[model samples]
Target: MGNIIQLSKSSPTSEWIDMSNQGTDCFLELLIMAANDLEKTNHQEKLISFLKDQKDINDIAPGTAGFKLDEMPWCDETLIDDASFLICVTKEAQSESVLSKLPYKVNTEIVFPWLKQFAVLIELMITASER
Candidate 1:
Protein backbone atom coordinates (compact mmCIF):
# COMPACT_ATOMS: atom_id res chain seq x y z
CA MET A 1 0.00 0.00 0.00
CA GLY A 2 1.12 3.51 -0.61
CA ASN A 3 2.08 5.64 2.36
CA ILE A 4 -0.66 8.17 3.04
CA ILE A 5 0.45 11.65 3.95
CA GLN A 6 -1.99 13.91 5.73
CA LEU A 7 -1.41 17.63 6.32
CA SER A 8 -3.35 19.61 8.89
CA LYS A 9 -3.22 23.13 10.20
CA SER A 10 -2.68 23.42 13.97
CA SER A 11 -5.28 26.14 14.28
CA PRO A 12 -8.52 26.63 12.41
CA THR A 13 -9.01 30.24 13.31
CA SER A 14 -5.73 31.44 11.83
CA GLU A 15 -6.03 34.56 9.75
CA TRP A 16 -6.03 34.06 6.01
CA ILE A 17 -3.13 35.60 4.18
CA ASP A 18 -3.25 36.67 0.60
CA MET A 19 -0.40 36.16 -1.78
CA SER A 20 1.31 39.20 -3.19
CA ASN A 21 1.34 39.60 -6.98
CA GLN A 22 4.99 38.58 -7.13
CA GLY A 23 4.41 35.61 -4.88
CA THR A 24 1.47 34.46 -6.97
CA ASP A 25 3.57 34.74 -10.10
CA CYS A 26 6.39 32.79 -8.51
CA PHE A 27 3.96 30.12 -7.36
CA LEU A 28 2.64 29.70 -10.89
CA GLU A 29 6.16 29.26 -12.17
CA LEU A 30 6.96 26.67 -9.54
CA LEU A 31 3.72 24.86 -10.27
CA ILE A 32 4.58 24.70 -13.93
CA MET A 33 7.98 23.26 -13.10
CA ALA A 34 6.40 20.60 -10.90
CA ALA A 35 3.82 19.76 -13.53
CA ASN A 36 6.49 19.45 -16.20
CA ASP A 37 8.47 17.10 -14.00
CA LEU A 38 5.46 14.86 -13.53
CA GLU A 39 4.66 14.94 -17.24
CA LYS A 40 8.21 14.17 -18.25
CA THR A 41 8.13 11.09 -16.03
CA ASN A 42 4.64 10.14 -17.32
CA HIS A 43 3.41 10.05 -13.74
CA GLN A 44 0.73 12.61 -14.49
CA GLU A 45 -0.99 10.57 -17.15
CA LYS A 46 -0.61 7.39 -15.17
CA LEU A 47 -2.29 8.93 -12.17
CA ILE A 48 -5.17 10.30 -14.19
CA SER A 49 -5.73 7.07 -16.01
CA PHE A 50 -5.53 5.08 -12.82
CA LEU A 51 -8.15 7.22 -11.17
CA LYS A 52 -10.45 6.97 -14.15
CA ASP A 53 -10.11 3.23 -14.33
CA GLN A 54 -10.63 2.80 -10.65
CA LYS A 55 -13.77 4.86 -10.79
CA ASP A 56 -15.08 2.73 -13.60
CA ILE A 57 -14.42 -0.59 -11.92
CA ASN A 58 -15.64 0.41 -8.53
CA ASP A 59 -18.78 2.14 -9.80
CA ILE A 60 -17.60 5.10 -7.80
CA ALA A 61 -19.68 8.21 -8.13
CA PRO A 62 -18.59 9.88 -11.32
CA GLY A 63 -16.35 12.93 -11.16
CA THR A 64 -13.98 11.23 -8.76
CA ALA A 65 -11.26 11.14 -11.37
CA GLY A 66 -9.28 13.42 -9.07
CA PHE A 67 -7.68 16.71 -9.96
CA LYS A 68 -5.54 17.27 -12.99
CA LEU A 69 -1.98 18.27 -12.19
CA ASP A 70 -2.77 21.79 -13.25
CA GLU A 71 -5.93 21.86 -11.19
CA MET A 72 -3.99 21.50 -7.95
CA PRO A 73 -3.73 24.74 -5.98
CA TRP A 74 -0.71 26.95 -6.32
CA CYS A 75 1.68 27.79 -3.47
CA ASP A 76 -0.03 31.09 -2.64
CA GLU A 77 -3.06 29.17 -1.46
CA THR A 78 -5.10 28.61 1.66
CA LEU A 79 -4.33 25.64 3.87
CA ILE A 80 -7.95 24.59 4.08
CA ASP A 81 -8.35 24.48 0.31
CA ASP A 82 -5.09 22.66 -0.20
CA ALA A 83 -5.72 20.22 2.60
CA SER A 84 -9.17 19.41 1.32
CA PHE A 85 -7.84 18.64 -2.13
CA LEU A 86 -5.09 16.49 -0.69
CA ILE A 87 -7.51 14.55 1.47
CA CYS A 88 -9.90 13.92 -1.39
CA VAL A 89 -7.16 12.78 -3.72
CA THR A 90 -5.59 10.56 -1.08
CA LYS A 91 -8.84 8.88 -0.23
CA GLU A 92 -9.66 8.22 -3.85
CA ALA A 93 -6.19 6.95 -4.61
CA GLN A 94 -6.09 4.72 -1.57
CA SER A 95 -9.43 3.19 -2.42
CA GLU A 96 -8.10 2.27 -5.83
CA SER A 97 -5.80 -0.61 -6.70
CA VAL A 98 -3.14 1.73 -8.00
CA LEU A 99 -1.88 2.51 -4.50
CA SER A 100 -0.42 -0.99 -4.16
CA LYS A 101 1.26 -0.86 -7.54
CA LEU A 102 4.99 -0.49 -8.01
CA PRO A 103 5.65 3.08 -9.04
CA TYR A 104 2.83 4.45 -6.92
CA LYS A 105 4.01 2.67 -3.79
CA VAL A 106 7.50 4.04 -4.40
CA ASN A 107 6.27 7.45 -5.47
CA THR A 108 4.27 7.84 -2.29
CA GLU A 109 7.46 8.00 -0.26
CA ILE A 110 9.18 10.24 -2.77
CA VAL A 111 6.26 12.62 -3.31
CA PHE A 112 5.06 13.17 0.25
CA PRO A 113 8.30 14.80 1.35
CA TRP A 114 8.18 17.18 -1.57
CA LEU A 115 4.56 17.98 -0.79
CA LYS A 116 5.45 18.70 2.83
CA GLN A 117 8.19 21.01 1.67
CA PHE A 118 5.77 22.72 -0.65
CA ALA A 119 3.31 23.19 2.20
CA VAL A 120 6.06 24.79 4.26
CA LEU A 121 6.91 27.04 1.36
CA ILE A 122 3.28 28.09 1.13
CA GLU A 123 3.24 29.04 4.78
CA LEU A 124 6.46 30.98 4.38
CA MET A 125 5.18 32.74 1.29
CA ILE A 126 2.00 33.70 3.06
CA THR A 127 4.02 35.22 5.86
CA ALA A 128 6.33 36.99 3.47
CA SER A 129 3.47 38.29 1.40
CA GLU A 130 1.85 39.73 4.48
CA ARG A 131 4.79 41.96 5.22
Candidate 2:
Protein backbone atom coordinates (compact mmCIF):
# COMPACT_ATOMS: atom_id res chain seq x y z
CA MET A 1 0.00 0.00 0.00
CA GLY A 2 0.99 3.67 -0.28
CA ASN A 3 1.16 3.96 3.50
CA ILE A 4 4.39 2.04 3.79
CA ILE A 5 8.04 2.95 4.43
CA GLN A 6 10.99 0.65 4.34
CA LEU A 7 14.48 1.18 5.75
CA SER A 8 17.38 -1.12 5.14
CA LYS A 9 20.84 -1.16 6.66
CA SER A 10 23.80 -1.85 4.44
CA SER A 11 25.81 -3.60 7.13
CA PRO A 12 23.25 -4.79 9.59
CA THR A 13 24.87 -5.94 12.78
CA SER A 14 24.54 -9.60 13.66
CA GLU A 15 22.21 -9.13 16.58
CA TRP A 16 18.96 -10.75 17.74
CA ILE A 17 16.20 -9.07 19.81
CA ASP A 18 13.48 -10.56 22.04
CA MET A 19 9.99 -9.19 22.55
CA SER A 20 8.33 -11.79 24.76
CA ASN A 21 8.90 -9.66 27.87
CA GLN A 22 8.63 -6.31 26.11
CA GLY A 23 6.70 -3.70 28.08
CA THR A 24 6.68 0.02 28.85
CA ASP A 25 9.93 0.11 30.81
CA CYS A 26 12.07 -2.04 28.54
CA PHE A 27 11.04 -0.86 25.10
CA LEU A 28 11.95 2.82 25.35
CA GLU A 29 15.43 2.13 26.70
CA LEU A 30 16.35 -0.21 23.88
CA LEU A 31 14.74 1.92 21.21
CA ILE A 32 16.77 4.98 22.16
CA MET A 33 19.88 2.86 22.14
CA ALA A 34 19.10 1.31 18.78
CA ALA A 35 18.33 4.68 17.28
CA ASN A 36 21.65 5.93 18.53
CA ASP A 37 23.40 2.96 16.99
CA LEU A 38 21.67 3.26 13.65
CA GLU A 39 22.72 6.90 13.47
CA LYS A 40 26.32 5.83 13.31
CA THR A 41 26.06 4.51 9.79
CA ASN A 42 25.81 6.55 6.61
CA HIS A 43 23.23 6.15 3.85
CA GLN A 44 20.14 5.20 5.80
CA GLU A 45 17.85 4.19 2.96
CA LYS A 46 14.34 5.47 3.69
CA LEU A 47 11.66 4.30 1.29
CA ILE A 48 8.23 5.85 1.60
CA SER A 49 6.04 3.14 0.16
CA PHE A 50 2.92 5.23 0.69
CA LEU A 51 4.19 8.08 -1.46
CA LYS A 52 6.02 8.20 -4.72
CA ASP A 53 9.78 8.61 -4.59
CA GLN A 54 10.96 12.26 -4.93
CA LYS A 55 7.43 13.41 -4.17
CA ASP A 56 6.83 16.49 -2.06
CA ILE A 57 6.47 15.76 1.65
CA ASN A 58 3.26 17.76 1.58
CA ASP A 59 1.88 15.18 -0.82
CA ILE A 60 1.64 12.58 1.93
CA ALA A 61 0.09 14.22 4.94
CA PRO A 62 -1.28 12.14 7.81
CA GLY A 63 -0.44 8.77 6.31
CA THR A 64 1.01 5.69 8.00
CA ALA A 65 4.43 4.81 6.66
CA GLY A 66 5.56 1.21 7.07
CA PHE A 67 9.08 0.09 7.83
CA LYS A 68 10.99 -2.70 6.18
CA LEU A 69 10.87 -4.50 9.48
CA ASP A 70 7.27 -5.37 10.24
CA GLU A 71 8.00 -5.57 13.95
CA MET A 72 8.19 -1.79 14.06
CA PRO A 73 5.07 0.34 13.85
CA TRP A 74 3.96 2.18 10.74
CA CYS A 75 5.65 5.47 11.64
CA ASP A 76 3.65 8.52 10.69
CA GLU A 77 6.42 10.98 9.88
CA THR A 78 4.27 13.70 8.39
CA LEU A 79 5.09 17.20 9.55
CA ILE A 80 3.12 20.38 9.22
CA ASP A 81 6.26 22.32 8.26
CA ASP A 82 9.08 19.82 7.86
CA ALA A 83 10.20 16.41 9.01
CA SER A 84 11.99 16.31 12.36
CA PHE A 85 12.60 12.60 12.74
CA LEU A 86 16.32 13.23 12.71
CA ILE A 87 15.92 15.31 15.85
CA CYS A 88 15.92 12.06 17.78
CA VAL A 89 19.40 11.30 16.53
CA THR A 90 22.29 12.12 18.82
CA LYS A 91 25.21 14.43 18.02
CA GLU A 92 27.55 11.45 18.26
CA ALA A 93 25.71 9.76 15.40
CA GLN A 94 26.34 10.43 11.78
CA SER A 95 24.91 13.68 10.47
CA GLU A 96 23.01 13.06 7.30
CA SER A 97 21.74 16.20 5.60
CA VAL A 98 19.17 14.07 3.84
CA LEU A 99 17.40 13.51 7.15
CA SER A 100 16.83 17.23 7.49
CA LYS A 101 15.06 17.25 4.14
CA LEU A 102 12.62 14.55 5.21
CA PRO A 103 9.28 15.64 6.67
CA TYR A 104 8.78 14.46 10.26
CA LYS A 105 6.59 15.30 13.20
CA VAL A 106 6.78 13.86 16.70
CA ASN A 107 3.63 12.36 18.18
CA THR A 108 4.53 12.38 21.84
CA GLU A 109 0.98 11.78 22.97
CA ILE A 110 0.57 8.80 20.68
CA VAL A 111 4.15 7.58 20.90
CA PHE A 112 4.81 8.02 24.62
CA PRO A 113 3.08 4.89 25.85
CA TRP A 114 4.33 2.83 22.94
CA LEU A 115 8.00 3.25 23.86
CA LYS A 116 7.96 0.02 25.85
CA GLN A 117 6.66 -2.05 22.98
CA PHE A 118 9.15 -0.32 20.72
CA ALA A 119 12.00 -1.25 23.00
CA VAL A 120 10.85 -4.85 23.23
CA LEU A 121 10.63 -5.10 19.47
CA ILE A 122 14.11 -3.64 19.13
CA GLU A 123 15.38 -6.26 21.50
CA LEU A 124 13.91 -8.95 19.31
CA MET A 125 15.40 -7.33 16.20
CA ILE A 126 18.83 -7.04 17.75
CA THR A 127 18.61 -10.57 19.08
CA ALA A 128 17.61 -11.88 15.70
CA SER A 129 20.47 -9.97 14.14
CA GLU A 130 22.86 -11.69 16.50
CA ARG A 131 21.63 -15.15 15.63
Candidate 3:
Protein backbone atom coordinates (compact mmCIF):
# COMPACT_ATOMS: atom_id res chain seq x y z
CA MET A 1 0.00 0.00 0.00
CA GLY A 2 1.08 3.57 -0.66
CA ASN A 3 1.94 5.94 2.17
CA ILE A 4 -0.71 8.01 3.87
CA ILE A 5 -0.19 11.43 5.49
CA GLN A 6 -3.09 12.85 7.42
CA LEU A 7 -3.09 16.36 8.85
CA SER A 8 -5.37 18.22 11.21
CA LYS A 9 -5.44 21.70 12.66
CA SER A 10 -5.21 20.22 16.13
CA SER A 11 -6.08 17.20 18.19
CA PRO A 12 -9.73 16.62 19.13
CA THR A 13 -10.78 18.33 15.93
CA SER A 14 -13.02 16.48 13.57
CA GLU A 15 -11.54 17.99 10.43
CA TRP A 16 -8.47 16.31 9.01
CA ILE A 17 -7.00 16.53 5.55
CA ASP A 18 -5.49 13.57 3.77
CA MET A 19 -2.47 14.56 1.77
CA SER A 20 -0.99 11.08 1.40
CA ASN A 21 -2.77 10.20 -1.80
CA GLN A 22 -1.32 13.28 -3.48
CA GLY A 23 2.10 12.32 -2.12
CA THR A 24 5.18 14.50 -2.09
CA ASP A 25 4.83 15.14 -5.82
CA CYS A 26 2.12 17.66 -5.17
CA PHE A 27 4.30 19.56 -2.75
CA LEU A 28 7.20 19.50 -5.17
CA GLU A 29 4.99 20.87 -7.93
CA LEU A 30 3.85 23.73 -5.75
CA LEU A 31 7.40 24.51 -4.71
CA ILE A 32 8.46 24.53 -8.34
CA MET A 33 5.63 26.87 -9.17
CA ALA A 34 6.67 29.16 -6.38
CA ALA A 35 10.26 28.97 -7.50
CA ASN A 36 9.20 29.88 -11.04
CA ASP A 37 7.44 32.92 -9.66
CA LEU A 38 10.59 33.85 -7.80
CA GLU A 39 12.63 33.45 -10.98
CA LYS A 40 10.42 35.89 -12.87
CA THR A 41 11.21 38.43 -10.17
CA ASN A 42 14.95 38.17 -10.83
CA HIS A 43 15.52 35.75 -7.98
CA GLN A 44 17.30 33.23 -10.17
CA GLU A 45 20.03 32.52 -7.65
CA LYS A 46 17.61 31.57 -4.93
CA LEU A 47 15.57 29.44 -7.31
CA ILE A 48 18.59 27.49 -8.53
CA SER A 49 19.92 27.06 -5.03
CA PHE A 50 16.60 25.88 -3.67
CA LEU A 51 16.13 23.39 -6.49
CA LYS A 52 19.61 22.01 -5.96
CA ASP A 53 19.00 21.57 -2.27
CA GLN A 54 15.71 19.84 -2.94
CA LYS A 55 17.36 17.45 -5.35
CA ASP A 56 20.17 16.73 -2.94
CA ILE A 57 17.73 15.90 -0.20
CA ASN A 58 15.62 13.73 -2.43
CA ASP A 59 18.67 11.84 -3.66
CA ILE A 60 19.79 10.90 -0.21
CA ALA A 61 19.10 7.31 0.82
CA PRO A 62 16.40 6.84 3.40
CA GLY A 63 17.51 6.67 7.09
CA THR A 64 20.74 8.39 6.15
CA ALA A 65 19.65 12.02 6.15
CA GLY A 66 16.30 13.31 7.27
CA PHE A 67 14.34 16.03 5.55
CA LYS A 68 14.22 19.43 7.16
CA LEU A 69 11.86 22.28 6.42
CA ASP A 70 13.93 25.07 7.96
CA GLU A 71 16.81 24.30 5.63
CA MET A 72 14.96 25.92 2.75
CA PRO A 73 15.64 29.64 2.73
CA TRP A 74 13.20 32.40 1.92
CA CYS A 75 14.19 35.34 -0.25
CA ASP A 76 11.31 37.54 0.82
CA GLU A 77 9.44 37.93 4.05
CA THR A 78 6.20 38.69 2.24
CA LEU A 79 5.36 35.01 2.01
CA ILE A 80 7.81 33.73 4.58
CA ASP A 81 5.23 33.00 7.24
CA ASP A 82 2.74 31.39 4.93
CA ALA A 83 5.38 29.64 2.89
CA SER A 84 6.90 28.29 6.05
CA PHE A 85 3.58 26.73 6.93
CA LEU A 86 3.41 25.06 3.55
CA ILE A 87 6.97 23.86 3.84
CA CYS A 88 6.43 22.36 7.28
CA VAL A 89 3.34 20.55 6.10
CA THR A 90 5.18 19.25 3.08
CA LYS A 91 8.07 18.08 5.25
CA GLU A 92 5.78 16.26 7.62
CA ALA A 93 4.04 14.62 4.71
CA GLN A 94 7.32 13.48 3.25
CA SER A 95 8.55 12.13 6.57
CA GLU A 96 5.34 10.26 7.12
CA SER A 97 5.65 8.73 3.67
CA VAL A 98 8.93 7.16 4.67
CA LEU A 99 7.69 6.04 8.05
CA SER A 100 4.69 4.42 6.39
CA LYS A 101 7.03 1.94 4.75
CA LEU A 102 7.12 -0.03 8.00
CA PRO A 103 4.21 -2.06 9.31
CA TYR A 104 2.79 1.09 10.86
CA LYS A 105 0.67 4.07 9.91
CA VAL A 106 1.77 7.65 10.36
CA ASN A 107 -0.69 10.39 11.21
CA THR A 108 0.66 13.89 11.64
CA GLU A 109 -1.09 16.76 13.30
CA ILE A 110 -0.30 20.45 12.85
CA VAL A 111 -1.59 23.11 15.19
CA PHE A 112 -1.72 25.94 12.70
CA PRO A 113 -4.82 27.02 10.83
CA TRP A 114 -3.03 26.52 7.57
CA LEU A 115 -5.49 24.56 5.50
CA LYS A 116 -7.85 27.43 4.69
CA GLN A 117 -5.10 30.01 4.55
CA PHE A 118 -2.65 28.13 2.40
CA ALA A 119 -4.61 28.60 -0.82
CA VAL A 120 -5.05 32.30 -0.15
CA LEU A 121 -1.38 32.72 0.60
CA ILE A 122 -0.32 31.00 -2.61
CA GLU A 123 -2.67 33.16 -4.63
CA LEU A 124 -1.38 36.26 -2.94
CA MET A 125 2.21 35.35 -3.64
CA ILE A 126 1.47 34.56 -7.28
CA THR A 127 -0.42 37.80 -7.77
CA ALA A 128 2.25 39.81 -6.03
CA SER A 129 4.97 38.22 -8.13
CA GLU A 130 3.11 39.02 -11.33
CA ARG A 131 3.42 42.71 -10.60
Predicted structure with the largest TM-score when compared to the true one? 3
TM-score on alpha carbons, each prediction: 0.26, 0.29, 0.30
lDDT of 3 by residue, 1-131 (tens): 12212222231223322233233334433344444333233343453356445445444532222222223344564444445444444334344344344343423332123233333444444455558
Model 3 is weakest, by summed lDDT over 10 consecutive residues, at 2-11
> For residues 1-131, what per-residue lDDT tens digits would candidate 2 score against the true structure?
23222223432332222222222112223233335444322222241221222123323432332233443233333321111232233221222342232245333344333443333433444455546
Q: How much does candidate 2 score in TM-score?
A: 0.29
lDDT, model 3, position 105: 42
In the range 1-131, model 1's lDDT, one tens digit per residue, is 11111122332223222233332222223333333333222343443343345334324332232222323334443434443343334333323243343232333443444444445534543454468
Pick out the ten consecutive residues of candidate 2 with the lowest summed lDDT: 16-25
Candidate 2 has an lDDT of 0.30
The local distance difference test score of each candidate is: 0.35, 0.30, 0.37
If candidate 2 were superposed on the true structure by all CA atoms, what would the RMSD be?
13.5
Best by lDDT: 3
What are the clashing pairs of model 1? none
What C-alpha lDDT does candidate 1 achieve relative to the native structure? Answer: 0.35
